[model samples]
Target: MVELTKQANPGGLGPTRVLLHRPPALTSPFMLPTTGESEQAATGERGRARAALLPQRVFKKPWPCEAAFIVNILVFVYGASIGWMSPMTLLLQSDKSPVGRPLSDAEISWIASIAYLTCVPADFLIAYLSDKIGRKNSLFLLSLTSVCCWAIKLCSYEVWAFVLARALMGIVMGGAYVTCPLYTKDISEDSVRGLLGSLVILFHTTGNLFSYIIGDLLSFRIVLWICLTIAIFHLILCIIIPESPSFLIKQGKEDKAVKILAWLRCRRETDSLVQREIEIIKKEQKTDENSSNFALKAILKDKILFRAFKIAIIVALAREVCGAIPVLNFAGDIFATASKGTNFVLTPNQQAMMLGLIQVTGSMLGSSVVEKAGRKALLAVTALISGISMCALASWFVAKSYGVDAASWLPLATLCICIFCDSSGLQPVSVIITSEIFSYKYRGTVMGTAMAAAAVCAFIQMFFFKNLATSIGLHVSFYFFGAVCMFAALYTILVIPETKLRSLEEVHQDLRTKKEKREEKALKEVSV
Candidate 1:
């Protein structure tokens, strides 16, 4: 019988486990010692060697994960900013409010919708900034803009000032969405990438819930100050962390990249693990230079990249158009419609708060399990379930229109199910997959393009959903969403590749191999 033991043992942790297919009688240097005495001797040698290699530290500094955590915390502020607008809008437009005069419906609509318009262009700018200026600088821009946005809100007395504030906040939203996922993917180890990637959504939902609570309890100006304070805190914390090593490498600063990678990985620059990772980044850069141009047209023309882009666009559209945004926007209306002539316990605001909590819970669960569960399975399952839930919701609305009494509970049940599925997989999985599918050369560009498309899709859905519900039928609009979700699930199973823990080169190579096999198969069929 043979035993398996770790090989290389880089960074003071066991590396790859190798099977020693050798007889016990033949002592091999490759095989780990099986005897208790030899094992103890080997451990001592390794500990001594590690001690010699590692520099002595007076105190343990935080790991790279802490930097990721600090940067992602801004998402909470962004979420709170979004959630604050919902309740504060009511107060701002009230007849007895402090704005001096109640705002017109037109102004309110513009205030709510202006962010989408600003975000479309800002999305592309954010992508460029993240790739060109580096992730740390890009994040500083996001924080600075967020603080400015809140400051505008704190002092604004005119309708245009509120519009300007919303527009600035739109920059914060778009920048965070474009930059955070890419930065997290760059800074994280494969072991924790999924969990770290999920932080974007987790913090976002938590912020949304926090805003709901605080918006209820605090004055509007005070809430703006709270958001401003958080943004400033993020700026200070982020200033201390090193720039992403990948970004540093991209900028041709190899020495800086090495130092940053060492610090991030908590290993010496001379360590084999650090050198290996640095070599990988260098190799990836060379490969990107040799294999593909960074032009938009060139990237879209590449068959594998084009296919990946298509998958990304489809998933983005599905995430937005699957009625999640509209449902969130019209939560009160849906609750009211469902609770008509019934004894449903929660008010619209109460139901919104509950939904926010559900979103945060689902995101937290997703963060914990995404790595364990894998991406493709979770996405497929969640998309299918979300489709079914939406269909069930549509059926309930149809029944309500037809005067059915028993379908009242269906609305609440289906809505919760939809939101849960969205937060758990359909939403977070897309962000991870998008960041994974592209090479470093065009990661920011592709992510930005996808985000811009998603923003537009969301804007369209939010704008037309109520109108469609009023004119055609609520069930019809919902049925369309259900169909999109079903299509998204089917696409994932048939076309989307599993990317968990895989390197970009490995992922692209896998895609190329699959494409070649399909081409050969088609040629054989044609010959026959």
Candidate 2:
């Protein structure tokens, strides 16, 4: 008979190894194995033969990227929801409106901005749900909410119906931001975390592009059905994916955590790398368990955490006020304004589609280069570019107003640059920084609060941006947005730390003042 024994390493600091031993009787050449031993050996041989018959790659453990791709499907759906309004607004306000009347500016603003307003409350709710019910469950709930949102739109064309539908989408939007980044952070290895984290914006931009293209080509009912189908698909995928290992560990499911982490890393559960990661997660969870009950209060009390929180909020708000959302939502109107007297070749919907393509291309480039470029540098550079592009757009608008015959293509070109910069760096890097700076205990709460603030800013912009442009001139609005983007660039250079392939402690250490570091060193020496 063969015996399998697991031997623990010294101090339990290393991986447990399994040794196979034969009984003394079986060790003898003349000895015969028992029936049970024979069956076990046969089964093992068959298993080995089957494994060998298949390709080597077939047996390889799954990568975290696969999980990230699945999770970010919801993000893609959220992007589509965002893009839907761009073309749909034009359709709704046209003479052939399906609602039987042209939507008033106030009504269109409500439809466009209501989602952002509702997101504020939904952020906290999702934060709580993410901690309580687990990340995967929260995602499932959000996917269902998306389905409901699209379903409402499919069922009715009334102004109230559209507004109500957008409100439900708010819940999904708020929850997706709160949950997906945390989920991505938890599953990803430090080496590829930035790449995977950027996938959120990548998928999001692709969704936006998808929606823009389809909304232009397809009928209203068809577009709604397609979006509804996507929501359902995301819901199904959420059910199959595992809960985040961090959440599993926090819930005291160490065994399950190890299994999932091992799978995510493409290693066996007993592999040393997997064991080390599991230990790290356990340690983090233990430390968090010892901390204060209220995450918000804890953040407020700790200078380092509070600083990180502030950085997160600042970057998040910067991403929003940099004017991506309003531009995306009111793209048709912007294009119409810009092409007022120009020989522009593309229609407004086509122009918006072009912007969507720029976003996807930029997001892909960003995801590919994020780890190499590092978060801080990419964000600063992109913000600077976006600011420049916005300023150029404003300049063109100003020139046109003064009857200066600048090249008509200038606005389209500058808008493309702005959208590209946004997807490539401003949006994704902000999200990556927010997810990387905090531990699991504080991640959900901090992210929720920051996104809530961002939602408020977005709501304000969406509600009043058109009016603001009308009243103060589009040039003024562009200047304001450009200024904010420039500020974001400055802040990134001055304040934000490089988080690429870095640990939370290392990143937080960068945030500490020199005086605090000296005081900490002195305290350590005294304790010694």
Candidate 3:
């Protein structure tokens, strides 16, 4: 869900309006918070100190540490797709996927569902273990899991083996997806949080696109082998990357974190600058540390934080049901059926694959403009436009069946619109918003939960979509999705605040205040 601002735009293309950039360090109205890491945690402390350290704010460049953007792209391109489509299609074929035993789409759907269900609990477990030991180490372990899964799938090609491999892939992919952003946030400067956040999904989209092509469009074996090899190579990059600065500080290794920070910048920064920044971060860390409650309990108690969590989760879930997966994953079959028994010569899977790749291209562009296009504004506009497009496509199909002339470009246009909505707005927004909205202590947990919604919803929708489309009719199937988009739009407009250009603490404070107000109102109304 998170997009790397740099990779987000590929070469930086998006709305110039809501540009997400950290304000320059203050000049005259200087201020600093009094806190330490023991108080606010490393993230909270750094927020305050960085400002003080920059009397004449020099916009710190992006992460200097050895980044895994290209590798992340490879991991997502290969790892996630193995789960995305081929396996599901194989089940539908009443046979195993390109390699495995055959099962009905429904049965295979259930298998995929189970895989995602596992990711929910695994998210937090992975995070705890990653932090407890180290970020790079955790990723390395996961990389091995991916390698084994692909290799096993290549050899066994059986029903149970396929299922087991997918499940294994889910767990390892879980480690990469959850830990990457936290790791990126830890190592990078605040100025590019939005960009970094966006990267998480940019790579994910690329992965999905790869799946759409290699597994669904081209052939399962080709994609599987490609991913398997790439996963192996990515391990090399993992070695060069340093550990998270936050993790090091917690370990009482400030000197190491400092050195790594410079390394991440890939430039020789002065020690005075590093020392001053560390001191400031130390002070502010105190504020967050005193009463930080990152547990589910604190999340539930904090209504606004909880509100963001709820919305993020619901939207992530709803986005799946947008019928996008069903459409993209099963479009070939659906087209054949919708053709009224016609052979339907066109390749639906190939088209979908190409579309996914195009969307990745678009996402790369959108992320660059995140800083310029204001998060809320871009999301709202894209959602509405995309919803309308889906509705139109559904109507066009129903009309064409009734002997109305629905032109060829109609369906293609609808798909393109969906990609635009998804890559540019929905995908990036889901991860970035979730990351920015939650306090640092609670961010990983909430993101894990939110992302779980996407995984779960995707499983449900992908499996049942064919049946649902047949029962409800393709026209109505898209309509229901359109309705979901509309609802998301309304909720975003009314409740979701603009997070662009705001400090993470400022956003957290707003949530905390809203919760306090709600509590105050409840207290005033109580008679007991």
Candidate 4:
């Protein structure tokens, strides 16, 4: 027997009318099966048999990728801003200076290094914003900094204006690093998470290439206008994308979360897979909610979480201090020195453009193979290669300092290898692994802390790198970076677990100490 009932709709449109099946009790007169009911049961069996003969249908949703792509547009803009400095610096200090006076050496150094300093605070601020306002809203708000950055440049050619613009750009840089990874991880499925996470670096490198090409070829004002237009375009796109379903669940809006998750997965709200995923999210959130300690305190108290946090911090620092930033920032000077007494002749702008192309190429390759290669293996291999390449470059410089002659191409070749390895594996995989190892409650806090530390390392490198290279030898700096990369490789091989296609609980289980595992086993046996 079918009974009509009213139920709350999970989609939140309105009350839904439902038909519930009510089987009669054996004691009731209606318990006896009627001839009509027997006929209906036979018909249902026949229908089921016919349905089983047909092929099962599958759906492949493009919504996750589409959302990730749109959100990463801000990341692309952030990359362009970083790349803009390399070319724009040359113009600012030239005879055709827009400010009517070439910037002093001190002023130029301030402009270059100030952004890294600003990134420190912005990192933490974004962590708070991402949680309070939602990932989509935080990203939308932070994107305005990029828009303001370009608008300031267009408004004035004054030195102060340029510095302020770069400072704002730094805020966007910090926020993007924190928010984009969280947003992408929340939206992506386990199978495609690595690929989508890798897109962060891919988009960043592509933006670098965009800026290098345009800043090299276009007029100063024209490049500024183009960048501004892209920033505005991102703002418009940001307004329309869905908020993360995970964030929605946290806000007690499960009905809306279900709708958004179904839309993101391109499945029906009542689909088994969708329902299972929702249950998983709720279980995770419930675990977090039941904890009495604050997020950071909880991480500190938990052995597994603390270990994971350490891994995240170590890899993040390794990526920043691996010498890529300094090499890219001072590419022209390195190229000039490397090309001396050699037939290799290229303008500074052309050299920067070439490095940009190498970066994009490496990032693309990394994104394509990340899922297949897995995060741990890829990070270790790249870090090792980058270390070896850096050591080679150092040896070449030392050879030059002595009377011994080396191949003219050695320095450039090694530098390219370092940059390529960094983009393809070290950088992107570090980010992917960090996002994969933590639960939703602690993700923002851990990411914020790690990135803020990275920003500090980057600031130190930017401020003192040139002076260190000059005071000591460039070879000494290279050797230090090489040592760090080698250390990162060794650490990854020994301690880090493969996180590709793994859930947060699975990854955390691997992170547990042997003692912890034994204790857990004992507890399970006792319960049994």
lDDT, candidates in the order shown? 0.81, 0.85, 0.65, 0.86
Between the candidate structures 1 and 4, which one is better when assessed by TM-score? 4
Model 4 lDDT, residue 354, Cα: 87
TM-score of 1: 0.87
Residues 246-265 of candidate 4: C-alpha lDDT, one tens digit per residue: 89999999988887776676
lDDT (10s digit) by residue, model 2, range 100-166: 9899988987897888888999999999999999999999999999999999998899999999999
lDDT of 4 at 234: 97
Cα lDDT tens digits for candidate 3, 1-528:
111222134356774332232333323221211222222332465455443333222334334323747336434833364435543464346543454345665556555655676676677777777657777777777777777877887787666776877777778656666777767666555556667667776777777766665555445566668777877787666665677666677678887767666445432335465665566455544554665445577667756557777867876765666666776667677556555534444565556666677678868876787767877877787788878988998888888888885665677668678877777877777667776665445656776776676777777776677777778788888888899888888878887777886765566555555667788679989955
Candidate 3 all-Cα RMSD: 11.9
**Candidate 1: stretches off by over 4 Å:** 1-62, 291-293, 513-528
| Candidates 1 and 3 compared by TM-score, better number | 1
TM-score comparison, 3 vs 4, better candidate: 4
| Candidate 3 lDDT (Cα, 0 to 1) | 0.65
> Which of candidates 2 and 3 is the stronger one according to TM-score?
2
The model with the greatest TM-score is 4
Residue 245, model 2: Cα distance from true site in angstroms? 1.1
Which stretches in model 3 have alpha-carbon errors above 4 Å? 1-74, 77-80, 83-114, 211-224, 266-285, 292-294, 337-345, 401-403, 512-528
Clashes of each: 0, 0, 48, 0
Per-residue error for 68 in candidate 1, Å, reads: 1.0
